[model samples]
Target: MAAKTVTIESKDYVFNTLKEAQNYYDAIVKELYNAKLTLTTGQDFEDLKWIYSTYCHYTKQNLDKLSNSDITGFKGISTVREKGGQYIPTECCAIIFSDSSSNCTEEEFFTDKALKEIAIKQNPR
Candidate 1:
């Protein structure tokens, strides 16, 4: 399908799919790490690249497997909706974010094996 041109909040941004928008965002991150964000360099820069690249590599693959419809997370409803804020797509807010839908504050998604690992760490055999 052809990507539609769109403008929001006095800014013209066009992205056909979530993947396209993500690639654009990732490019910006690369600019920040290697160039624009001047402060950290060498290992810190490499580490940041590694961390975000790994996240992008795997998630992008997973995202490719899903239909665009499924990616429209929460579809038009959000409890913590911010007024007058740049609307972040579901793709942008997937991981590293907490919301009413996927609240992982307590690490509730950890498996039973993780509990055992924590116990062993606290009380080693």
Candidate 2:
């Protein structure tokens, strides 16, 4: 079957399947990381590179397993309508994160004084 073509914000692309869309998502993330590294310093670049590489490797490894059904999970349709006898999916917004985990304690969330004290104690420079 021929791939479906879609346009986003005036950009056009042909997606063979949902896997292609997933690959596009991963590519965008990698490119964003690369751009950030171009604007950052030694420690920040190294840390971001390590994080981006890990994510990219995992995404590429699982790319083949993605399908059309998975695409629905990535975006939510606000309304479905029949136009010219064809049903179209109208996306309201994309789902960016699935995990709702919080990494910081209530003290960290409420105040940065504790964090600053810890940093000063550790560095002392």
Candidate 3:
């Protein structure tokens, strides 16, 4: 099958292979890390760092060790909702990549480190 294309924010990432996808994902994580460092602190900075950390934790294993399923599963959209029912999307940190086929909310995506860790366990090397 042809590779799937996932867009996080306005950037477009095309994955022709598992490795390709993971590389893109890793690159994005690194980019987020760098971006976080440039920010002045507060919500935006913390949010970016959080995503970078979470991505690292999720993709800590060698990229070669990941399977096709692992790559495909980690596709998501970046957005979060405020307490007043407002949806907010931040480019500095929010990465919308997930493995579960179910829909995930912004709250679960950003604040659910446990879920990410579980996903790592589910797709062991």
Candidate 4:
């Protein structure tokens, strides 16, 4: 198949054709390739992968916190209205991904910690 032959223009650079744009990017990558991996041995690569994985997980959580309806926004904790019309905190552990957008019990998480917080919230002294 023939490649697109249209010219591409960005801020200050104009690429005559798709191949030219690709070659331009390829050249930039080649120029920086050695510098990017010069100090990275197998162990260094593994460490970077580990750190990147953690970074992705951490950022996803933080981003979730910024949203009102994200599970991590409340750390998978929620509330349920009981038969008596009273409400109770519920923990979903790692199952739910987005916040239910309902009220979550105050600072209640893990069972023990959550129970304490629930008690404190219910009967503050």
- By lDDT, the best candidate is 3
Which wins on lDDT, candidate 2 or candidate 3? 3
Tell me the tens digit of each residue's lDDT in model 1 across 15-76: 34444444544444444434424323454333333333333343364333232222111111
Once fitted onto the true fold, the runs of candidate 4 whose alpha carbons sit more than 4 angstroms away are 1-10, 37-125
Off by over 4 Å in 3: 1-14, 37-125
List per-prediction Cα lDDT, in the order shown. Answer: 0.30, 0.31, 0.38, 0.33
List TM-score per model, in order: 0.24, 0.22, 0.23, 0.24
Question: Candidate 1: where is the Cα deviation over 4 Å?
Answer: 1-10, 36-125
Model 2: lDDT of residue 22: 43
State the lDDT of candidate 3 residue by residue for 28-124, as single tens digits: 5445545553233444344333444445456674333222112211223344456568767532233333245644322123323422353344345
Worst 10 residues of 4 by lDDT: 106-115
The residue pairs in collision within model 2 are none
lDDT of 2 by residue, 1-125 (tens): 43333222112333344344444544433454344322133432333233333333434532332221121112222345467999985322222222224221110010112223322333344
**For model 4, how does the per-residue alpha-carbon lDDT over 1-125 read when each residue is reduced to its tens digit?**
43333222122233444555445433433333333322223432332223223333433543444345422221233345354777774432222233565644223223222223322333334
Runs in model 2 with CA error above 4 Å?
1-9, 37-125
